[model samples]
Target chain A: MKTKKIATYGLLVSLAFILSYLESLFPIPIPIPGIKIGVANLVVMIALYGFGSTQAFVLSIIRIILVGFTFGNLSTMMYSLAGGLLSCLLMILFKKLKFFSMVGVSIIGGISHNIGQILMAILILESASIINYLPALLITGTITGTLIGIIGGLIEKRLKKFLVNY
Target chain B: MIKKNDFILIGIILAIVLLIWSLSFFKINWPMNFFMKTEGSKVRITVDGQEYKILDLDKDTTFSIEQENGKFNTFEIRDGYVDMIDASCPDKICVHQKEIHYDHETIVCLPNKVVLEIIDGQVNEVDSVAN
Candidate 1:
Protein backbone atom coordinates (compact mmCIF):
# COMPACT_ATOMS: atom_id res chain seq x y z
CA MET A 1 0.00 0.00 0.00
CA LYS A 2 1.16 3.53 -0.70
CA THR A 3 2.15 5.78 2.22
CA LYS A 4 -0.68 8.15 1.31
CA LYS A 5 -3.24 5.32 1.52
CA ILE A 6 -1.87 4.27 4.91
CA ALA A 7 -2.10 7.84 6.16
CA THR A 8 -5.68 8.12 4.93
CA TYR A 9 -6.60 4.94 6.75
CA GLY A 10 -5.09 6.23 9.98
CA LEU A 11 -6.82 9.58 9.61
CA LEU A 12 -10.24 8.06 8.93
CA VAL A 13 -9.96 5.50 11.73
CA SER A 14 -8.98 8.12 14.32
CA LEU A 15 -11.72 10.44 13.13
CA ALA A 16 -14.30 7.68 13.48
CA PHE A 17 -13.02 6.81 16.96
CA ILE A 18 -13.17 10.43 18.09
CA LEU A 19 -16.68 10.83 16.71
CA SER A 20 -17.88 7.77 18.61
CA TYR A 21 -16.37 9.09 21.83
CA LEU A 22 -17.96 12.48 21.33
CA GLU A 23 -21.34 10.87 20.62
CA SER A 24 -21.22 8.83 23.84
CA LEU A 25 -20.68 12.03 25.82
CA PHE A 26 -24.05 13.40 24.67
CA PRO A 27 -26.83 10.93 25.03
CA ILE A 28 -29.89 11.37 22.85
CA PRO A 29 -32.97 12.40 24.82
CA ILE A 30 -34.85 9.35 23.58
CA PRO A 31 -35.21 6.67 26.24
CA ILE A 32 -34.42 3.85 23.84
CA PRO A 33 -31.11 2.07 24.37
CA GLY A 34 -28.81 1.72 21.29
CA ILE A 35 -30.25 4.73 19.53
CA LYS A 36 -27.81 7.38 18.31
CA ILE A 37 -27.22 9.81 15.43
CA GLY A 38 -24.36 7.55 14.34
CA VAL A 39 -21.98 10.39 13.60
CA ALA A 40 -19.06 7.97 13.31
CA ASN A 41 -20.75 6.31 10.36
CA LEU A 42 -20.18 9.47 8.39
CA VAL A 43 -16.48 8.64 8.34
CA VAL A 44 -17.18 5.11 7.20
CA MET A 45 -19.51 6.32 4.46
CA ILE A 46 -16.88 8.72 3.20
CA ALA A 47 -14.25 6.02 3.22
CA LEU A 48 -16.51 3.63 1.36
CA TYR A 49 -17.38 6.19 -1.30
CA GLY A 50 -13.90 7.65 -1.65
CA PHE A 51 -11.71 4.58 -1.27
CA GLY A 52 -13.61 1.27 -1.42
CA SER A 53 -15.40 -1.40 0.59
CA THR A 54 -12.16 -2.93 1.94
CA GLN A 55 -10.95 0.38 3.34
CA ALA A 56 -14.36 1.19 4.80
CA PHE A 57 -14.63 -2.27 6.38
CA VAL A 58 -11.19 -2.01 7.95
CA LEU A 59 -11.84 1.47 9.28
CA SER A 60 -15.21 0.42 10.73
CA ILE A 61 -13.83 -2.63 12.53
CA ILE A 62 -10.86 -0.80 14.02
CA ARG A 63 -13.04 2.11 15.14
CA ILE A 64 -15.63 -0.14 16.73
CA ILE A 65 -12.96 -2.04 18.66
CA LEU A 66 -11.28 1.12 19.86
CA VAL A 67 -14.54 2.79 20.91
CA GLY A 68 -15.91 -0.38 22.46
CA PHE A 69 -12.87 -0.79 24.71
CA THR A 70 -12.61 2.88 25.59
CA PHE A 71 -16.22 3.78 26.31
CA GLY A 72 -18.12 0.49 26.60
CA ASN A 73 -17.96 -3.15 27.74
CA LEU A 74 -18.00 -6.56 26.10
CA SER A 75 -21.76 -6.66 25.56
CA THR A 76 -21.69 -3.17 24.16
CA MET A 77 -18.88 -4.21 21.84
CA MET A 78 -21.00 -7.05 20.55
CA TYR A 79 -23.87 -4.74 19.80
CA SER A 80 -21.63 -2.24 18.02
CA LEU A 81 -19.95 -4.95 16.03
CA ALA A 82 -23.24 -6.38 14.88
CA GLY A 83 -24.64 -3.01 13.87
CA GLY A 84 -21.43 -1.85 12.21
CA LEU A 85 -20.96 -4.96 10.16
CA LEU A 86 -24.55 -5.10 8.96
CA SER A 87 -24.67 -1.42 8.12
CA CYS A 88 -21.33 -1.46 6.27
CA LEU A 89 -22.28 -4.49 4.22
CA LEU A 90 -25.66 -3.12 3.28
CA MET A 91 -24.25 0.30 2.43
CA ILE A 92 -21.65 -1.24 0.17
CA LEU A 93 -24.23 -3.35 -1.56
CA PHE A 94 -26.58 -0.41 -2.07
CA LYS A 95 -23.79 1.77 -3.39
CA LYS A 96 -22.82 -0.93 -5.85
CA LEU A 97 -26.38 -1.36 -7.11
CA LYS A 98 -26.36 2.29 -8.24
CA PHE A 99 -30.10 2.59 -7.86
CA PHE A 100 -29.99 5.00 -4.95
CA SER A 101 -27.89 8.00 -4.06
CA MET A 102 -25.73 8.38 -0.98
CA VAL A 103 -28.74 9.58 0.98
CA GLY A 104 -30.69 6.43 0.23
CA VAL A 105 -27.73 4.18 1.01
CA SER A 106 -27.16 5.98 4.30
CA ILE A 107 -30.81 5.61 5.21
CA ILE A 108 -30.59 1.88 4.64
CA GLY A 109 -27.40 1.83 6.70
CA GLY A 110 -29.04 3.67 9.61
CA ILE A 111 -32.18 1.56 9.71
CA SER A 112 -30.28 -1.71 9.30
CA HIS A 113 -27.86 -0.69 12.04
CA ASN A 114 -30.76 -0.18 14.42
CA ILE A 115 -32.35 -3.44 13.36
CA GLY A 116 -29.06 -5.25 13.90
CA GLN A 117 -28.59 -3.80 17.37
CA ILE A 118 -32.18 -4.50 18.36
CA LEU A 119 -31.85 -8.08 17.23
CA MET A 120 -28.73 -8.45 19.38
CA ALA A 121 -30.54 -6.88 22.33
CA ILE A 122 -33.41 -9.31 21.93
CA LEU A 123 -31.00 -12.22 21.89
CA ILE A 124 -29.12 -11.03 24.97
CA LEU A 125 -32.25 -10.09 26.92
CA GLU A 126 -34.25 -13.09 25.74
CA SER A 127 -37.35 -10.96 25.36
CA ALA A 128 -39.31 -10.64 22.14
CA SER A 129 -41.34 -7.74 23.57
CA ILE A 130 -38.35 -5.44 23.21
CA ILE A 131 -39.19 -5.29 19.53
CA ASN A 132 -41.74 -2.63 20.47
CA TYR A 133 -39.06 0.00 19.98
CA LEU A 134 -38.77 -0.73 16.26
CA PRO A 135 -41.06 1.96 14.94
CA ALA A 136 -39.47 4.80 16.85
CA LEU A 137 -36.00 3.55 16.01
CA LEU A 138 -36.83 3.32 12.33
CA ILE A 139 -38.05 6.89 12.21
CA THR A 140 -35.06 8.32 14.02
CA GLY A 141 -32.66 6.28 11.95
CA THR A 142 -34.19 7.60 8.74
CA ILE A 143 -33.94 11.21 9.83
CA THR A 144 -30.38 11.00 11.11
CA GLY A 145 -29.24 8.97 8.13
CA THR A 146 -30.54 11.60 5.75
CA LEU A 147 -28.65 14.32 7.56
CA ILE A 148 -25.41 12.37 7.59
CA GLY A 149 -25.78 11.45 3.93
CA ILE A 150 -26.26 15.02 2.82
CA ILE A 151 -23.24 16.20 4.75
CA GLY A 152 -21.15 13.27 3.54
CA GLY A 153 -22.16 13.90 -0.05
CA LEU A 154 -20.96 17.51 0.18
CA ILE A 155 -17.67 16.53 1.79
CA GLU A 156 -16.99 13.83 -0.78
CA LYS A 157 -17.59 16.25 -3.62
CA ARG A 158 -14.92 18.63 -2.32
CA LEU A 159 -12.51 15.83 -1.34
CA LYS A 160 -12.78 14.12 -4.73
CA LYS A 161 -10.24 16.46 -6.33
CA PHE A 162 -7.56 15.78 -3.68
CA LEU A 163 -8.39 12.07 -3.35
CA VAL A 164 -7.55 11.36 -6.98
CA ASN A 165 -3.86 12.07 -6.41
CA TYR A 166 -3.65 9.38 -3.74
CA MET B 1 -27.51 14.99 -5.42
CA ILE B 2 -30.70 13.21 -4.33
CA LYS B 3 -31.79 10.86 -7.12
CA LYS B 4 -35.24 9.61 -8.07
CA ASN B 5 -34.50 6.24 -6.52
CA ASP B 6 -33.71 7.93 -3.23
CA PHE B 7 -37.24 9.28 -3.05
CA ILE B 8 -38.60 5.87 -3.99
CA LEU B 9 -36.59 4.21 -1.26
CA ILE B 10 -37.77 6.71 1.33
CA GLY B 11 -41.35 6.29 0.19
CA ILE B 12 -41.13 2.55 0.61
CA ILE B 13 -39.70 2.94 4.11
CA LEU B 14 -42.42 5.42 5.04
CA ALA B 15 -45.06 3.02 3.82
CA ILE B 16 -43.61 0.33 6.03
CA VAL B 17 -43.48 2.69 8.99
CA LEU B 18 -47.13 3.58 8.52
CA LEU B 19 -48.17 -0.04 8.17
CA ILE B 20 -46.40 -1.08 11.40
CA TRP B 21 -47.47 2.00 13.35
CA SER B 22 -51.10 1.46 12.49
CA LEU B 23 -51.01 -2.26 13.22
CA SER B 24 -49.59 -1.81 16.71
CA PHE B 25 -51.81 1.17 17.42
CA PHE B 26 -54.95 -0.64 16.44
CA LYS B 27 -53.97 -3.83 18.20
CA ILE B 28 -53.87 -1.93 21.46
CA ASN B 29 -56.70 0.55 20.91
CA TRP B 30 -59.40 -1.01 18.75
CA PRO B 31 -59.88 -4.75 18.57
CA MET B 32 -58.65 -5.85 22.00
CA ASN B 33 -60.42 -3.05 23.83
CA PHE B 34 -63.60 -3.57 21.87
CA PHE B 35 -63.69 -7.28 22.61
CA MET B 36 -62.79 -7.87 26.28
CA LYS B 37 -61.93 -4.58 28.01
CA THR B 38 -58.50 -5.79 29.13
CA GLU B 39 -56.74 -3.74 31.80
CA GLY B 40 -53.30 -4.03 33.30
CA SER B 41 -53.75 -5.11 36.89
CA LYS B 42 -50.29 -6.49 37.62
CA VAL B 43 -46.75 -5.30 36.99
CA ARG B 44 -44.41 -8.15 36.13
CA ILE B 45 -40.72 -7.57 36.75
CA THR B 46 -37.98 -9.71 35.26
CA VAL B 47 -34.22 -9.77 35.48
CA ASP B 48 -32.15 -11.53 32.84
CA GLY B 49 -35.32 -13.10 31.41
CA GLN B 50 -36.18 -14.77 34.72
CA GLU B 51 -39.32 -13.89 36.62
CA TYR B 52 -38.43 -11.73 39.61
CA LYS B 53 -41.73 -10.51 41.05
CA ILE B 54 -45.28 -9.66 40.12
CA LEU B 55 -46.78 -6.73 42.00
CA ASP B 56 -50.39 -5.63 42.17
CA LEU B 57 -50.93 -2.31 40.51
CA ASP B 58 -53.83 -1.37 42.80
CA LYS B 59 -51.52 -1.11 45.80
CA ASP B 60 -49.13 1.78 45.43
CA THR B 61 -45.69 0.60 46.49
CA THR B 62 -41.98 0.86 45.75
CA PHE B 63 -39.68 -2.04 44.84
CA SER B 64 -35.91 -2.19 44.54
CA ILE B 65 -33.49 -4.90 43.41
CA GLU B 66 -29.74 -4.97 43.74
CA GLN B 67 -27.97 -7.77 41.97
CA GLU B 68 -24.70 -9.33 43.16
CA ASN B 69 -22.99 -7.75 40.21
CA GLY B 70 -23.79 -4.36 41.80
CA LYS B 71 -26.42 -3.48 39.22
CA PHE B 72 -29.56 -2.01 40.78
CA ASN B 73 -33.02 -0.80 39.79
CA THR B 74 -35.91 0.76 41.66
CA PHE B 75 -39.49 1.25 40.54
CA GLU B 76 -42.75 2.47 41.97
CA ILE B 77 -46.38 1.60 41.37
CA ARG B 78 -48.69 4.54 41.94
CA ASP B 79 -52.32 5.00 40.91
CA GLY B 80 -52.31 1.94 38.71
CA TYR B 81 -49.21 3.08 36.83
CA VAL B 82 -45.69 1.66 36.99
CA ASP B 83 -42.70 3.99 36.77
CA MET B 84 -38.98 3.32 36.95
CA ILE B 85 -37.76 5.66 39.68
CA ASP B 86 -34.06 4.88 39.84
CA ALA B 87 -31.30 2.67 38.44
CA SER B 88 -27.51 2.17 38.61
CA CYS B 89 -27.22 1.95 34.83
CA PRO B 90 -25.29 4.78 33.18
CA ASP B 91 -27.95 5.82 30.69
CA LYS B 92 -30.95 5.60 33.06
CA ILE B 93 -33.17 5.46 29.97
CA CYS B 94 -35.67 3.38 31.90
CA VAL B 95 -36.14 6.09 34.49
CA HIS B 96 -36.79 8.64 31.79
CA GLN B 97 -39.26 6.41 29.97
CA LYS B 98 -42.91 7.21 30.34
CA GLU B 99 -44.80 5.45 33.10
CA ILE B 100 -46.97 2.64 31.76
CA HIS B 101 -50.49 1.66 32.76
CA TYR B 102 -51.85 -0.24 29.78
CA ASP B 103 -51.46 -3.92 29.08
CA HIS B 104 -48.43 -4.85 26.93
CA GLU B 105 -46.55 -1.66 27.83
CA THR B 106 -42.99 -2.09 29.09
CA ILE B 107 -40.10 -0.22 30.66
CA VAL B 108 -36.71 -1.79 29.98
CA CYS B 109 -33.34 -1.07 31.56
CA LEU B 110 -31.04 -2.77 29.10
CA PRO B 111 -27.78 -2.18 30.95
CA ASN B 112 -29.16 -3.78 34.10
CA LYS B 113 -30.97 -6.54 32.24
CA VAL B 114 -34.23 -5.56 33.89
CA VAL B 115 -37.70 -5.47 32.32
CA LEU B 116 -41.01 -4.27 33.72
CA GLU B 117 -44.16 -5.23 31.84
CA ILE B 118 -47.83 -4.50 32.36
CA ILE B 119 -49.80 -7.72 32.36
CA ASP B 120 -53.52 -7.99 31.68
CA GLY B 121 -55.35 -7.92 34.96
CA GLN B 122 -59.12 -8.51 34.55
CA VAL B 123 -61.72 -9.34 31.92
CA ASN B 124 -64.38 -6.76 32.51
CA GLU B 125 -68.11 -6.33 31.59
CA VAL B 126 -67.40 -6.29 27.88
CA ASP B 127 -66.40 -9.93 27.84
CA SER B 128 -69.56 -11.04 29.61
CA VAL B 129 -71.74 -8.98 27.30
CA ALA B 130 -70.08 -10.45 24.24
CA ASN B 131 -70.45 -13.97 25.58
Candidate 2:
Protein backbone atom coordinates (compact mmCIF):
# COMPACT_ATOMS: atom_id res chain seq x y z
CA MET A 1 0.00 0.00 0.00
CA LYS A 2 1.48 3.28 -1.08
CA THR A 3 1.40 6.25 1.29
CA LYS A 4 -0.57 8.27 -1.24
CA LYS A 5 -3.20 5.56 -1.49
CA ILE A 6 -3.43 5.31 2.28
CA ALA A 7 -3.88 9.05 2.58
CA THR A 8 -6.60 9.03 -0.07
CA TYR A 9 -8.42 6.29 1.80
CA GLY A 10 -8.28 8.28 5.00
CA LEU A 11 -9.58 11.39 3.31
CA LEU A 12 -12.41 9.58 1.57
CA VAL A 13 -13.39 7.74 4.72
CA SER A 14 -13.64 10.98 6.68
CA LEU A 15 -15.68 12.58 3.92
CA ALA A 16 -18.05 9.65 3.97
CA PHE A 17 -18.28 9.81 7.76
CA ILE A 18 -19.20 13.48 7.67
CA LEU A 19 -21.81 12.89 5.00
CA SER A 20 -23.36 10.14 7.12
CA TYR A 21 -23.50 12.48 10.09
CA LEU A 22 -25.08 15.26 8.07
CA GLU A 23 -27.60 12.83 6.66
CA SER A 24 -28.65 11.61 10.10
CA LEU A 25 -29.15 15.14 11.36
CA PHE A 26 -31.76 15.89 8.72
CA PRO A 27 -33.74 12.77 8.01
CA ILE A 28 -35.55 12.72 4.68
CA PRO A 29 -39.07 14.08 5.04
CA ILE A 30 -40.47 10.78 3.90
CA PRO A 31 -41.76 8.72 6.79
CA ILE A 32 -40.51 5.44 5.40
CA PRO A 33 -37.96 3.68 7.54
CA GLY A 34 -34.49 2.79 6.19
CA ILE A 35 -34.79 5.23 3.30
CA LYS A 36 -31.76 7.44 2.67
CA ILE A 37 -30.21 9.33 -0.20
CA GLY A 38 -26.96 7.48 0.57
CA VAL A 39 -24.66 10.46 -0.01
CA ALA A 40 -21.79 8.47 1.48
CA ASN A 41 -22.14 6.16 -1.48
CA LEU A 42 -20.76 8.87 -3.70
CA VAL A 43 -17.45 8.49 -1.92
CA VAL A 44 -17.56 4.74 -2.35
CA MET A 45 -18.31 5.07 -6.05
CA ILE A 46 -15.41 7.46 -6.41
CA ALA A 47 -13.15 5.02 -4.66
CA LEU A 48 -14.36 2.23 -6.92
CA TYR A 49 -13.63 4.14 -10.10
CA GLY A 50 -10.59 6.09 -8.90
CA PHE A 51 -9.13 3.34 -6.76
CA GLY A 52 -10.25 -0.29 -7.00
CA SER A 53 -12.85 -2.74 -5.74
CA THR A 54 -10.76 -3.77 -2.74
CA GLN A 55 -10.26 -0.16 -1.75
CA ALA A 56 -13.94 0.62 -2.28
CA PHE A 57 -14.94 -2.37 -0.14
CA VAL A 58 -12.52 -1.42 2.60
CA LEU A 59 -13.63 2.18 2.53
CA SER A 60 -17.33 1.22 2.65
CA ILE A 61 -16.85 -1.15 5.60
CA ILE A 62 -14.84 1.35 7.56
CA ARG A 63 -17.33 4.11 6.83
CA ILE A 64 -20.30 1.99 7.91
CA ILE A 65 -18.61 0.87 11.14
CA LEU A 66 -17.48 4.37 12.02
CA VAL A 67 -20.83 5.95 11.21
CA GLY A 68 -22.74 3.15 12.90
CA PHE A 69 -20.91 3.49 16.17
CA THR A 70 -20.86 7.26 16.15
CA PHE A 71 -24.45 7.99 15.13
CA GLY A 72 -26.38 4.70 15.59
CA ASN A 73 -26.73 1.56 17.72
CA LEU A 74 -26.02 -2.13 17.27
CA SER A 75 -29.17 -2.86 15.29
CA THR A 76 -28.59 0.17 13.11
CA MET A 77 -25.06 -0.98 12.55
CA MET A 78 -26.35 -4.38 11.46
CA TYR A 79 -28.67 -2.76 8.94
CA SER A 80 -25.95 -0.50 7.58
CA LEU A 81 -23.56 -3.44 7.31
CA ALA A 82 -26.07 -5.49 5.38
CA GLY A 83 -26.95 -2.69 3.00
CA GLY A 84 -23.37 -1.51 2.60
CA LEU A 85 -21.97 -4.92 1.80
CA LEU A 86 -24.68 -5.87 -0.63
CA SER A 87 -24.55 -2.57 -2.49
CA CYS A 88 -20.79 -2.60 -2.65
CA LEU A 89 -20.68 -6.10 -4.09
CA LEU A 90 -23.32 -5.33 -6.66
CA MET A 91 -21.63 -2.12 -7.74
CA ILE A 92 -18.37 -3.96 -8.16
CA LEU A 93 -20.01 -6.69 -10.20
CA PHE A 94 -21.82 -4.23 -12.39
CA LYS A 95 -18.68 -2.19 -12.94
CA LYS A 96 -16.83 -5.35 -13.95
CA LEU A 97 -19.44 -6.24 -16.55
CA LYS A 98 -18.75 -2.91 -18.28
CA PHE A 99 -22.21 -2.95 -19.76
CA PHE A 100 -23.35 0.05 -17.77
CA SER A 101 -21.77 3.41 -17.13
CA MET A 102 -21.19 4.91 -13.72
CA VAL A 103 -24.80 6.05 -13.61
CA GLY A 104 -26.04 2.55 -14.28
CA VAL A 105 -23.75 0.99 -11.72
CA SER A 106 -24.68 3.49 -9.03
CA ILE A 107 -28.39 3.00 -9.69
CA ILE A 108 -27.96 -0.72 -9.17
CA GLY A 109 -26.02 -0.01 -5.99
CA GLY A 110 -28.78 2.20 -4.62
CA ILE A 111 -31.56 -0.28 -5.37
CA SER A 112 -29.63 -3.21 -3.91
CA HIS A 113 -28.83 -1.23 -0.80
CA ASN A 114 -32.55 -0.75 -0.09
CA ILE A 115 -33.31 -4.35 -0.89
CA GLY A 116 -30.57 -5.47 1.49
CA GLN A 117 -31.94 -3.38 4.34
CA ILE A 118 -35.50 -4.58 3.71
CA LEU A 119 -34.33 -8.17 3.70
CA MET A 120 -32.58 -7.56 6.99
CA ALA A 121 -35.72 -5.97 8.37
CA ILE A 122 -37.78 -8.97 7.29
CA LEU A 123 -35.35 -11.31 8.98
CA ILE A 124 -35.16 -9.35 12.22
CA LEU A 125 -38.85 -8.50 12.39
CA GLU A 126 -39.86 -12.00 11.23
CA SER A 127 -42.68 -10.48 9.22
CA ALA A 128 -43.12 -10.65 5.49
CA SER A 129 -45.74 -7.89 5.39
CA ILE A 130 -43.02 -5.30 5.70
CA ILE A 131 -42.26 -6.06 2.08
CA ASN A 132 -45.03 -3.65 1.19
CA TYR A 133 -42.53 -0.78 1.11
CA LEU A 134 -40.48 -2.33 -1.71
CA PRO A 135 -41.98 -0.39 -4.60
CA ALA A 136 -41.66 2.96 -2.93
CA LEU A 137 -38.17 2.13 -1.81
CA LEU A 138 -37.17 0.97 -5.25
CA ILE A 139 -38.43 4.17 -6.81
CA THR A 140 -36.63 6.36 -4.32
CA GLY A 141 -33.48 4.32 -4.70
CA THR A 142 -33.55 4.70 -8.45
CA ILE A 143 -34.05 8.45 -8.29
CA THR A 144 -31.36 9.02 -5.68
CA GLY A 145 -28.97 6.66 -7.44
CA THR A 146 -29.34 8.54 -10.69
CA LEU A 147 -28.60 11.83 -8.99
CA ILE A 148 -25.55 10.48 -7.19
CA GLY A 149 -24.29 8.82 -10.35
CA ILE A 150 -24.54 12.09 -12.25
CA ILE A 151 -22.59 13.84 -9.56
CA GLY A 152 -20.11 10.98 -9.42
CA GLY A 153 -19.62 11.10 -13.16
CA LEU A 154 -18.75 14.78 -13.00
CA ILE A 155 -16.36 14.26 -10.09
CA GLU A 156 -14.69 11.29 -11.73
CA LYS A 157 -13.75 13.37 -14.74
CA ARG A 158 -11.93 15.97 -12.66
CA LEU A 159 -10.52 13.38 -10.25
CA LYS A 160 -8.96 11.43 -13.08
CA LYS A 161 -6.61 14.30 -13.84
CA PHE A 162 -5.26 14.40 -10.30
CA LEU A 163 -5.47 10.69 -9.45
CA VAL A 164 -3.51 9.40 -12.39
CA ASN A 165 -1.75 6.02 -11.77
CA TYR A 166 -3.75 5.44 -8.52
CA MET B 1 -22.55 9.61 -18.68
CA ILE B 2 -25.55 7.34 -19.25
CA LYS B 3 -25.43 4.32 -21.53
CA LYS B 4 -28.00 2.47 -23.63
CA ASN B 5 -28.08 -0.34 -21.09
CA ASP B 6 -28.80 2.17 -18.33
CA PHE B 7 -32.04 3.18 -20.01
CA ILE B 8 -32.93 -0.47 -20.44
CA LEU B 9 -32.22 -1.09 -16.77
CA ILE B 10 -34.45 1.81 -15.76
CA GLY B 11 -37.18 0.53 -18.04
CA ILE B 12 -36.95 -2.90 -16.50
CA ILE B 13 -37.15 -1.48 -12.99
CA LEU B 14 -40.14 0.70 -13.88
CA ALA B 15 -41.84 -2.31 -15.40
CA ILE B 16 -41.29 -4.30 -12.22
CA VAL B 17 -42.61 -1.43 -10.15
CA LEU B 18 -45.71 -1.22 -12.32
CA LEU B 19 -46.24 -4.95 -12.03
CA ILE B 20 -45.99 -4.89 -8.24
CA TRP B 21 -48.13 -1.77 -7.93
CA SER B 22 -50.83 -3.27 -10.14
CA LEU B 23 -50.74 -6.59 -8.31
CA SER B 24 -51.14 -4.98 -4.89
CA PHE B 25 -53.74 -2.58 -6.26
CA PHE B 26 -55.82 -5.39 -7.74
CA LYS B 27 -55.44 -7.53 -4.63
CA ILE B 28 -56.83 -4.76 -2.46
CA ASN B 29 -59.32 -3.12 -4.81
CA TRP B 30 -60.99 -5.59 -7.15
CA PRO B 31 -61.13 -9.38 -6.93
CA MET B 32 -60.59 -9.99 -3.20
CA ASN B 33 -63.19 -7.44 -2.17
CA PHE B 34 -65.59 -8.80 -4.79
CA PHE B 35 -65.58 -12.21 -3.13
CA MET B 36 -65.03 -11.42 0.59
CA LYS B 37 -67.09 -8.64 2.07
CA THR B 38 -65.43 -6.45 4.67
CA GLU B 39 -68.19 -6.33 7.21
CA GLY B 40 -65.64 -5.21 9.78
CA SER B 41 -61.93 -5.22 10.50
CA LYS B 42 -59.87 -5.32 13.69
CA VAL B 43 -56.48 -3.97 14.51
CA ARG B 44 -54.14 -6.80 15.49
CA ILE B 45 -51.20 -5.82 17.63
CA THR B 46 -48.16 -8.04 18.10
CA VAL B 47 -44.95 -7.87 20.05
CA ASP B 48 -41.93 -9.98 19.20
CA GLY B 49 -44.08 -12.00 16.80
CA GLN B 50 -46.61 -12.88 19.52
CA GLU B 51 -50.21 -11.67 19.53
CA TYR B 52 -50.57 -8.78 21.92
CA LYS B 53 -54.10 -7.48 21.48
CA ILE B 54 -56.89 -7.16 19.00
CA LEU B 55 -58.79 -3.88 19.03
CA ASP B 56 -62.06 -3.15 17.33
CA LEU B 57 -61.85 -0.48 14.66
CA ASP B 58 -65.42 0.65 15.01
CA LYS B 59 -64.87 1.86 18.55
CA ASP B 60 -62.41 4.72 18.76
CA THR B 61 -59.84 4.18 21.51
CA THR B 62 -56.23 4.67 22.40
CA PHE B 63 -53.95 1.78 23.42
CA SER B 64 -50.39 1.48 24.57
CA ILE B 65 -48.02 -1.46 24.83
CA GLU B 66 -45.04 -1.60 27.16
CA GLN B 67 -42.26 -3.85 25.98
CA GLU B 68 -40.06 -5.88 28.29
CA ASN B 69 -37.18 -3.55 27.52
CA GLY B 70 -39.15 -0.65 28.96
CA LYS B 71 -39.79 0.67 25.47
CA PHE B 72 -43.38 1.59 24.69
CA ASN B 73 -45.64 2.41 21.74
CA THR B 74 -49.10 3.97 21.77
CA PHE B 75 -51.65 3.87 18.99
CA GLU B 76 -55.18 5.09 18.43
CA ILE B 77 -58.08 3.59 16.57
CA ARG B 78 -60.46 6.10 15.00
CA ASP B 79 -63.16 5.79 12.38
CA GLY B 80 -61.97 2.39 11.13
CA TYR B 81 -58.33 3.49 10.86
CA VAL B 82 -55.42 2.59 13.11
CA ASP B 83 -52.75 5.23 13.71
CA MET B 84 -49.61 5.03 15.82
CA ILE B 85 -49.74 8.15 17.98
CA ASP B 86 -46.54 7.84 19.98
CA ALA B 87 -43.52 5.67 20.53
CA SER B 88 -40.36 5.58 22.61
CA CYS B 89 -38.30 4.50 19.62
CA PRO B 90 -35.86 7.12 18.36
CA ASP B 91 -36.82 6.83 14.69
CA LYS B 92 -40.56 6.92 15.33
CA ILE B 93 -41.11 5.67 11.83
CA CYS B 94 -44.20 3.82 12.93
CA VAL B 95 -45.75 6.95 14.34
CA HIS B 96 -45.16 8.78 11.11
CA GLN B 97 -46.51 5.99 8.94
CA LYS B 98 -49.92 6.54 7.40
CA GLU B 99 -52.91 5.21 9.27
CA ILE B 100 -53.94 1.76 8.11
CA HIS B 101 -57.56 0.74 7.50
CA TYR B 102 -57.43 -1.88 4.80
CA ASP B 103 -56.95 -5.51 5.65
CA HIS B 104 -53.30 -6.65 5.74
CA GLU B 105 -52.06 -3.06 6.10
CA THR B 106 -49.41 -2.79 8.83
CA ILE B 107 -47.42 -0.29 10.87
CA VAL B 108 -44.26 -1.79 12.31
CA CYS B 109 -41.94 -0.35 14.94
CA LEU B 110 -38.77 -2.36 14.59
CA PRO B 111 -37.00 -0.83 17.57
CA ASN B 112 -39.90 -1.65 19.84
CA LYS B 113 -40.69 -4.95 18.10
CA VAL B 114 -44.30 -3.89 17.78
CA VAL B 115 -46.52 -4.53 14.81
CA LEU B 116 -50.03 -3.23 14.16
CA GLU B 117 -51.93 -4.92 11.35
CA ILE B 118 -55.50 -4.77 10.08
CA ILE B 119 -57.25 -8.11 9.79
CA ASP B 120 -60.80 -9.18 8.98
CA GLY B 121 -62.85 -9.07 12.14
CA GLN B 122 -65.29 -11.84 11.31
CA VAL B 123 -64.74 -14.52 8.69
CA ASN B 124 -67.86 -14.75 6.54
CA GLU B 125 -69.13 -17.76 4.63
CA VAL B 126 -67.92 -16.24 1.37
CA ASP B 127 -64.33 -16.22 2.63
CA SER B 128 -64.62 -19.82 3.70
CA VAL B 129 -66.10 -20.83 0.37
CA ALA B 130 -63.29 -19.10 -1.50
CA ASN B 131 -60.70 -20.67 0.75
Scored by DockQ, the top model is 2
- lDDT tens digits by residue: candidate 2, B40-66: 488888898789898888899989898
Q: Please, what are the lDDT tens digits per residue for candidate 2 over residues A1-166? A: 4898778888999999999999999898664556999999999999999989999999999999999889999989988999999999999999999989999999999999999999988887776666767888899899999999999999999989777866
For model 2, state the Cα shift of residue A35 in Å: 0.9
Name the 10 consecutive residues with the lowest summed lDDT in model 2 chain B. B29-38
- On residues A66-135, what C-alpha lDDT tens digit does candidate 1 reach at each position? 9999999998899999899999999999999998899999999999999999998988887665676677
Question: How far in Å is the alpha carbon of A164 misplaced in model 1?
Answer: 1.4
Considering the two chains of model 1, state its CAPRI-style docking category. acceptable
Over 4 Å off, model 2: B28-44, B47-51, B54-113, B117-131
Instruction: Report the Cα lDDT for residue B39, model 2.
Output: 43
Instruction: Point out the worst 10-residue segment of candidate 2 chain A by lDDT.
Output: A124-133
State residue B64's C-alpha deviation in candidate 1, in Å.
6.3
